[model samples]
Target: MESIINTKILVVMTILALSTGLGSCKIVQFIFGDSLSDVGNNKYLSKSLANANLPWYGIDFGNGMPNGRFTNGRTVADIIGDKMGLPRPPAFLDPSLTEDIILENGVNYASGGGGILNDTGNLFIQKFSLDKQIELFQGTQELIRSKIGAKAAEKFFNGSNYVVALGSNDFINNYLLPVYRDSWTYTDSSFVAYLMDTLGGQLKLLYNLGARQVTVFGLGPMGCIPLQRVLSTTGDCQEKTNNLALSFNRAGQKLVNDLSKSLKNSSIKFGDAYEVVAGVINDPAKFGFNNSDSPCCSFGQIRPALTCIPASTLCEDRSKYVFWDEYHPSDKANEMIANEIIRKLGFLYVNGTNTPPPAPAPTHAHAHAPSPGS
Candidate 1:
């Protein structure tokens, strides 16, 4: 484990070395995954039970308005967009926007409760799986082609970065939930292997769809969160859940390494989110946080059994709390995590050292054709 951690640090250092000094490049972003990246995709789904389009969900947003993001404010995708000097990409499901406007900048296809596997978030009732998000992105490809022609669309997508952050729900909502728990049939290691394998194919699909720059966020310490703490009589971190999360994160690192090598003309960065959040959890004060184990928007009590709801008490100062609700991080915490990710992914080709070579110009064999008149 120490060796792997060291290797990950080395990889980050190498990327930092390569990405230093580059002034700017035209890098658009298309985010995928679950609630962690969902700007408002779940809000547009009629049957979606996993939605944050309610009070306190976006209390810290620009105007204190809930926009269906799971956090109290901007998500990691939104933060990255800010860092990249771009506005938060619109949700692909937003009916208020036109296809042309949605494709003007990349669109976010993330949905709360989404996972790498189709069956992972069945409890959500309606949520796009990673496969479905990719399919939606494929649809955007058609719109882009229609607007700018196929060749220009190819250049557009190749320059764009795809941010994917899912899989926590696969464990928290599926493997750990009583109704869908897989522990009876599969061990922790086996379950993580299943997730990694499924994700590998999904990543390949993005590559096929012209995504050459991608970032995958590793899972954090699930056992330390409030919801899991409430389940334990002792109210301490659940070691089993922590171990499972660590196992998945380690394997995810390996998956990123393998994909980086296999996919030519691509830049794949594994965001060490586990490390970042674990640091904040271990010493909340270090990150200017007062609470790490409890949710800030719980039902009046510090350790309330019920999580944030419409009537739940809100924190006086959300910035001091690491967690906003039971399962999601606060806006402040998301900002910290985003900063950590940007530190690693921020300068993605600073001096052209180890920079990914430009993707080959698109042809009929490159980007798949859109439907009739698409």
Candidate 2:
């Protein structure tokens, strides 16, 4: 495990070296996912209800103000970028974005409420779906070609890093919503299978588009999120939801491995978000946190205000809280999660020196779902 992690570090160190005048390799990041990964695209979705362009959100970022992130500070995506020495990819909808900027800094297509399936975030009404994100990426590919020519564009994209942080919203907003037919149309495992099949196709599309080094983040402990906990009378993590997430993550790790092998010259890594975040929630103090159940910024009596508005009550010290709101983590929690992700994945080379060999895939592909009572 350490060897693989070291290989990852080596890969990123190559980029860090380049960034510091040791080399001229251009390394930039492309980010995609739901709100947890969103930098500011949600702000551009004028009609979307699920947004974080409000008070207390991004309260610790660059200028200590909301910058379109859902949490009180940087999202996990932003923290990961910071850890890798790569500039945080600007939101794809940023009006000032240019083709040159993309070639230099890449772009973030992650928006609040985005999901793998096009229909997953329908209630949001104006969010990007994974397909839409890919479509925009394709458009970015064309935009760059117009500026730097096809060969140069291909080289840029091939060497750039791709970060895909999806799936959580697909379950949280769609499959679990009775308003959506998916909840009724498929059983838990079958739904996960459907998501995996779609994600497999999506990864293939990215490979075809010239992504060689990619890291796909798995869903964290969805059942343990504040929103899920509030659903239980005892305020415990929902076992069924947690089981569903475990099943999906198991499949996701397998998919990442299969794609790494099947796609020539590609190295895809799965970020084990579930275990790492679960560890934090299970024992917050072990990770410098004191509270993992209640959200730091909230307004409702039950906790998880859906959104943290100016009217919400704020925690005395966000650093002690695990969750920022109902759905996202506090900045401190994000940082911890980010560090763990980097430690585990080992490498991300938006533009680097060498590609490491694919790490061994996990042997287990499915977690046993608990029977009726147990």
Candidate 3:
């Protein structure tokens, strides 16, 4: 009787081990960054700067309800969520949601007007610093672990992908803004190094906390933002701003490379977001974008502080424009950018084995879906 009982216990243990191993194959995508990657986490936090609660923000999303996204419709995070076989990530602040939401589809900790440094947006007291955002992400993970087991948590982290899109605000809000410029005393190189080191340290922290895959975006061409264009003397891109962005991208790439070498078990991927976005800005015609300098919204000769309300004149065709407002890109442009990053992810993570399958032929309902070539 004792021998038979021991045999049953061994069988149960073996089955449990196999089940755990199989469950690890499921992927969970954890996204972190600024407005570009932010879906609606900012809306959950008590802050007036949050756009997820405003109208016209989700005009193109069918629901016509704002969910904290900065665009007229879905942002890149939504597209990436769909591609990863998960439902759109809910705002971390949605009062109705529970830990199950994150355990199933992951969570977003990104916020608008955020930066790597603490003092990036002092005026917006509600905005989260990059470090704070990471801390939130870790807290979410801890919640998941408590709900599930450590093995399950490891599987979720190991199979998941992380997407980060930021750095624009550091230039526009922190460095260029008169308030920060007057308060902080750092040269261009010094500032760049400080920001990069902080960002790099955060990335390492995420990995140490159990992130297996990560994609860090470099800064886009800051000089071409509608806000910057309006602020420039000749209504042209500011060369100094563009140069600063280039330096940041260069440093970001090096940091990603170093992290990849230092980490033993995980693969950290760096997306050339700088080049991808800069190409669209520099040669809009090549990417089916018509206007790259100014946005499709109302133009201000000095500051672009004008509102782009629904009553305002929207471009006849938003798909042709790269930017939808002073700072955010249109859904069409976001789709293109997301497709580019997806292709890059397939190349880097899949060992070039399985390319993203050709996007299905579009029907009228899904006309905005990316093409196979994308």
lDDT top scorer: 2
Task: State the TM-score for model 3.
Answer: 0.83
Residue-level lDDT of model 3, residues 79-192, one tens digit each, is 655655644556566676577667556677788778888778666667777888788888887887887678777777777778777787888888887688623687878888
Instruction: List candidate 1 stretches off by more than 4 Å.
Output: 1-26, 301-307, 346-374
lDDT of 1 at 294: 86
- The alpha-carbon RMSD values of the candidates against the true structure, listed in the order shown, are 15.0, 12.0, 5.8
User: Please, what are the lDDT tens digits per residue for candidate 1 over residues 176-265?
Assistant: 876875746777888999989999998988998899988899888989888888889998889888888899889988999999999999
Candidates ranked, most accurate by TM-score first: 2, 1, 3
TM-score of 1: 0.83
Q: Each model's C-alpha lDDT?
A: 0.77, 0.83, 0.71
Q: Any runs in candidate 3 off by more than 4 Å, and if so which?
A: 1-24, 50-52, 181-184, 299-303, 345-374
Residue pairs that clash (backbone atoms under 3 angstroms), model 2: 8-346, 27-351, 161-350
Q: TM-scores of the models, in the given order? A: 0.83, 0.86, 0.83
lDDT of 2 by residue, 1-374 (tens): 99999999999998775553234366888998899898889898899988998886766565555789898777777777765667778999999998767866889999899999999888988999999999999999888888767876787788788999988888989999899999999999999999999999999999999999899988888888889999788899988888888998999999999999899999999987678789999998998888999898888584556898877767767778899899998878877788788989885444344443232111111222122223
- The lDDT ranking, best first, is 2, 1, 3
Best by TM-score: 2
Better of 2 and 3 by TM-score: 2
lDDT of 3 at 19: 48
